[model samples]
Target: MAETSEARASASAPGGDAGGEDDKHDERMLECNICLDTARDAVVSMCGHLFCWPCLHQWLETRPSRQVCPVCKAAISRDKVIPLYGRGNTKQEDPRNKVPPRPAGQRTEPENTSGFPGFGFGEGFHMSFGIGAFPFGVFTSTFNFGDPRPSAAPRGTAQYDEEQFLSKIFLWVAILFVLWLIFA
Candidate 1:
């Protein structure tokens, strides 16, 4: 079945269907036989077979003195190995292969900052009063003059330790004062 179709197609064509010729033409185009990695500068052996340079070097290094070429099996001398830069017409296997590291001047600048404006670490104020939530915005009577509201406190109850709070406030104030003296 296949031969009949090939014969009919060949008879219909002028120069015996040029597909095979195209395949040979394409073969001469660069191709990597080792990793099948195609690229410009693909290494070519003295026997006229091609493979990527790094791939060929790695292969030879591992099995030195192995005269048989991997692709053609033609006898190859160890020194006949040649480097290829960018010859032949095969596309690189991985188009996005790693590029050489750029110099400092060519490197992209790092980002300076991230996130929303007018915000700093540990400095945020949010008040939400919706259904299924606490129904209150901050209302402090102690900070301003107001009638003393009735409060719940059992007898002999003690408030939070004042010493620790005072100490922390004093420490921060002292640090800030020192900084202000220097900067002002």
Candidate 2:
């Protein structure tokens, strides 16, 4: 009776031969579906299929439009899959070194704003209307009310010089046209 009981105890112990078989089965479960080898940088799909990150990345790139699990044919995406980090895993090789790294977990946070939140369309509204031919329409006056015009560019800059040169040219043209109207 004692011999039989000791035999039963030894067989069921975690350090026994049965435990080695269980470890092998667990390792097999972690094998990649694509390569049929032990998974490195393992990720599990939503459909519960295991794969190495490199294997899945290539599979995804092969058919970018139709991403599905190699095993179950269920819908899978990089973002939808979850990375598996075993207790024994050490940080040796970085996942980012691979062509396409494992997808990062999604995170969302509430927005924070410094000023008034709503749209500012109501406060500063303005409109202008003009009716003239194409070439002579340059003489038309532009009107503004609530909408503030942008400040002129700083002095000595290229934009400032260009604006000054154009303003003088337009002034001379306007004076010549007014004189022609009076003398004609």
**Per-prediction CA RMSD (Å):** 19.9, 13.9
Residue pair clashes in candidate 2: none
Winner by TM-score: 2
Residue runs of model 1 more than 4 Å from their true location after superposition: 1-28, 85-184
For 63-161, candidate 2 gives per-residue lDDT tens digits of 978988999899887788877777787865544255656456588887875565435422222223446774355355232222344555567977667
Which pairs of residues collide in model 1?
29-89, 30-88, 30-89, 40-86, 41-84, 41-85, 41-86, 41-87
Q: On residues 62-136, what C-alpha lDDT tens digit does candidate 1 reach at each position? A: 666575788888876445766543434356443213323223334778897746654332222221222332212
**TM-score between model 1 and native:** 0.30
Clashing pairs counted in every model: 8, 0
How big is the RMSD of model 1? 19.9
